[model samples]
Structure formats: structure tokens, C-alpha cells
Target: MYDFTTFVQSIGNFLHGQFSPGVATALEWTLVILIYLALYAILGLVLVYVERRVCAFFQLRLGPNRVGWAGTAQTVADALKLLLKEPVTVNKADKLLFNLAPFIITLAALTVISLVPFAKGLQAFDINIGLLFIVAVSSLGVVGILLAGWSSNNKYALIGAMRSGAQIVSYELSVGLSLLTMVLLTGTLQLSAIIETQANGWWIFKGHVPAVIAFFLYLTASIAEINRGPFDLPEAESELTAGFHTEYSGLKFAFFFLAEFVNMFTVAAIATTVFLGGWMPFHIGDWAGFNAVMDFLPPIFWFFLKVSAVIFLMMWFKWTFPRLRIDQLLKLEWKYLMPLNLMNLVFTAILVYLGWHG
Candidate 1:
């Protein structure tokens, strides 16, 4: 097996040997930042391409087939156009917050991804309260939306932002509770610990019905959290003319676009980590031969495979479901998901206490 941790340590040692300790540390930090920036840009372009191709197929039409072979360079070209376009300045907008909003959202997305365990020793930050940290940081995106809407001084933008605030606030409880149900089975908040506990089997298998229910609740709430279709009241183009970002243009608008894709990736990655088993290969009890065959593949491969499955599911919902009314969205969360989630949590807790859950 490839020792990823050792590889990272070797690079650090080489850097220290080439420079003073402080200089080496500074360089390491710079490299990490640059790597994450590159990752963010790459994910945005790749996800956009995947989304377009997937939706086109759903609609029985050809997607981006121009620019690069099979339309691979289409998103790249679009990104370049956004980079070169001049940002429109609103005469009466709050300059400080209007400009600052996108960075807040982009920062939240970047920061939360750091805590996810992509594979063993592949995580950037493995804090003890990783799960809690994710919940807190992910909630910050709504603040940016609110600021963007309010600062624009447009009623449509403000209404869109207000809807986003309510939607995120209501659905966030379901997301948190569903995750909490998993925490009961794992008995730890550390993301790495959660994956390690799943070595025997994933919670979705070991924890049984509650885990399955939690997984569904997580998906439903997460879809709403990221503002994907059916739950995308915040950016309803048909009604709000692009919603909270209506007043933004050029690079500013690009930031919001990038943030949405990044948020989608983050949501799916977290789901992969929590419910599906982060990078852990599947194994049936006492089946050494089968387990060994599964282990032949690398952990990173398993991690990405699970994440992609969850992403595809989200995309499927977006393309297939009709948009929900603001009232309907709230009612689904409060009246249905919340009550069911509470009962599921209690049931999971009993299972954990009785030693019925793995």
C-alpha cells in the first residue's frame, strides 16, 4: 500500500533541509494554500461539465460538445470569460458588504472541505470536533447570501435572500439531526475515527433501518442546504431574475456560481464520509477472501467512488423534481422530516445503548 502520510512527511523534511525552519514552515503554508486554490478551481470546472452533460442526457439533448473534445474545455472557456469581464458597479449598493459577500461563501466552502477525510492521512485538518465544525462552517454561506441580497438594495434580491435564510435555517436542523444519529453509532466526533469504526462495515449496513432513514434525511436536507432545484428558491430565475445574485455581474457573479458548485461537492463529500463510509472498502462479516478482493483497490479510489454516487443522486433529484413553493419547502422540513428525524434519533440511541448497532 502507498504510505501517503510518509510521503507528506518526506516532503516536509526535504523543505526543512533546504531552508531555515521558519522559512520552511512559511513555504509549506503557501504550498497548501496554492494546492487548495487549484483544487477549488478544478472541481468547479469538472462539476459544471458533469452537470451540463448529465442534465442534457436527462433532457434528451446534446450537451456541451464544442470547444474541447467531448466539450471538456467548455467550462474552462466559460471561467476565462468570467475572469476577463468587467464587474458592474451598482451606484447605490453597500460597497463593502456587496463586495465581501462572495468571499465569505467561498471561504466557508474551502474551510469545511479541509476537515473531510479524503483517505487515510489525506485530510488537511483533523480537529476533534470535525463534525461540529462542519455544521458551523457550512451554515456561514447563508450569511453571505443575506448580505449580498440586502446590500444590493433590490427588493427581489432581498426577498430571495430572506427565503434562503429561512430555508437553510429550517433544513439545517434535519441535516444536523441525521448526522447526530450516525454519531451515536460511531461514538466519536473525529472524522478519521468515524471512518476507522466503519472498518467492520458501514453504518448504513451495521446500524440498519435508522441509519438508512438518517441517510435519506441527510440527502433531503442537504439538497435543500445547497439550494439545488426543488429547494433552490433562493436563486429562482423564473421569479427573481437570478434571485440574490441578480445585481451581481462579471467576476462577482462568477464567485457565486463557483460557490454553488463548490458547496454541492462539499455536501456530497460529507455525506460520503458520514453515511457511506469514507474511503473504507466494503466487507461482509468473516469473509476474508471477499474483503481482501475489495481491499485490492486503494482507499482514495473508494472515497471518490462513494462521493460520486452521492453527487449523481443529488443531480438526479435536481433534474427530475419540480421546484417546491417556499411554503411547501418549509412544511416538508418542519412537519415531516423533523418529526421523523427526532424519532429516528431516539431509536438509534436505543440501538446503540443495547449494543445492537455496530
Candidate 2:
């Protein structure tokens, strides 16, 4: 059997030896950034198409299927249209910051991917502080949103930006606290190490009640953080008319849309990594036959499946729920989720101390 750990280490070592330290680091970062961009493009296309199909199915109507083999090329056509269109800048807008905002938001969305582990032994940095780095960087998107809104010099844009800033800042605490419970149980911040720690069992199962509660809290907070559905006051079409990007058009608008989709996937992927065992295949306790069957599946498949499931759940919630008022949103986070997460963390710590986990 090929030793996967050694293979990953060998690849890392080879890259290090093949280039100077600076060059190697640059190359690694370049590779990660490129992957992030590529995935952002692909997922945006796929998600748009998928959302259409899902909506059609729910409404019992036919979806896009005429463009290119069941409408597969529809997104491609949309891309070309956007590329050919001119980006319009609003009157009195700050030209420099107006143009810079989309790039900043996109970059912030892409940066989070570096810390996400796609499969066993497959991560970009695998830094000891991977979890914290992701949380910190992911939150920076709010700055870009605020900049976009303020720079537009439009009342609606300013309102959208303000809502986004408040929304993300409020929800991020719950998300961080929930993830902290997992880190405490696993005793590591590296995504790879956290996954490895779950080799025997997923934290969701191994940590029992606390893990379950944290998972739900993480889900709720992530929804608000990404500004999806019920929490999407920043872009409430009925209210702010496209939110922070109200004044943006053409490719600039595309950048914001792409970043939002990528952010959604990133949140789902992180949740899978922290609580759902990431690329680790499902296995029952000491079931050799079951494990053997599970092992036949590649690690990436497991990782993708888990992340996809989380995305579907989010989408379901989005379609089924009504938007919350800003005050209600904050109250849910601070009054309820924050306190509950604190208790969950303490309970998890006690469980760990009591030798309740594997």
C-alpha cells in the first residue's frame, strides 16, 4: 500500500528543495491563489445552474436547458455578456476605492481556501494556526463590503454596507466560539491535524452532545456570516436594491457575486473539516467490512460529499425561511447563540477532561 502521509511530505520537501525559500513560498501561494480563482469560477457557474434547476423542480417548471446541452453553457454565455459590458461608475463615487472594493472582497474570499484541507494530507499551508488565520481573513470581507457601499455615495449602498458590517461582526463571534469548542476537543488548530484526530471517529460523533450543539450553532452563524437568505439584509432586493454593490455593474458586479458563492462553499468546507471529519471516510465502530468498503472511495469524494451536503442544507434554509430584522439577528447571536456556545465549550472541555472522547 502506498503511504499517503509520506507522499504528501515528499511533495512538500521536493518543492522546498527545488526552489529557494522565497521562490518556493511564492510558488505555493500562487498555486493556491490560482486554485481558488479556478474553483470560484467553476463553482459560480455550477451553483447558478444548480440553483435554477432546484428552483424549477420545486415550482414544477422546466429550468434552463437550451443554451448548451441542458443549459450547461448558460453560465458561459452570461460570463461573455458581462465581460463585453461596460462597468459603470456612479456620479460622485470615489473612483479608486470604488474599483478596489470588488478585488478586495474577491481576494478575501479566495484567501480562506488556503487553510481548508480538501482531503487527507492535502492542504496548502497546514499552518499550526490555520483555524485562527481562516477566521481572521474571512472576516476581512466586511471591510471590502463597507468600502464598496461607502465609496458608491448612494444611500442604499451605504445602508447595505452598514447592515453587512453589523451582520458579519455579530455572527462571527458565534461561529468562532463554536469552532473553538472543536479546537479544544481536538487540541490542534491545523486543519490536517484536526482531520487526523478524527481518524477513529468524527468529532460530531466522538464528542457527542457538545459537538452536536456546536455544529448547529456553527451552521446558524455561518448563514449570517455569508449573508444568505434570511440574513441577507445587505442585498435585500426589496430593500436596498442589490445592497453594497448597488452602484456596481458588469464585471465588477460579477466579482461580488462570485465572491459570495465562494464564501458559501468556504464556510461549508470549514464546517466539514472541523466537525464532520473532512476527507475521512465513514466507518462504524470496529466494522472491518464496512471500513474496507468505505476505503475504496477516495478522500476527496468524502470531503466533497460532506461539504455539498452542508451547502444543500443552507440552500434549503434560505428558501424556507423569512429574513430577520437586524435587531432580531443580533439578538439571536448575542443573547442566545453566544451564551449557548459558551456553555457548549465549557461542557466540551469537561468532557475532554473526563476522558469522554476517543
TM-score of each: 0.97, 0.94
User: What does candidate 2's lDDT look like per residue over 1-358, in tens digits?
Assistant: 2236687677658889999988887877787678767878998888777767766766688889899998889888888898888999988999999999999998898788767888766666678998999999999999999999999999999999999999998888998999999998999998898998999999999889999999999999988998885899999999889999999999999999888888888999999999999999999999999999998899988899999899888888887788998899889998999999999999989988998877
Output candidate 2 Cα RMSD.
Answer: 2.1
State which candidate has the highest lDDT.
1
Over the stretch 1-358, how does candidate 1's per-residue lDDT look in tens digits? 6347888888899999999999999999898888888988898999999999999999999999998999999999999999999898689999999999999889998998888887888888899898999999999999999999999999999999999999999999999999999999999999999988988888888889999999999999989998996799999989999999999988889889988998998999888888888999988899889988999899999988998899999999999999999999999999999999999999999998889987
**Local lDDT at 98 for model 1:** 98
lDDT of 1: 0.91
Residue 18, candidate 2: C-alpha displacement in angstroms? 6.7
Count: clashes, candidate 2: 0
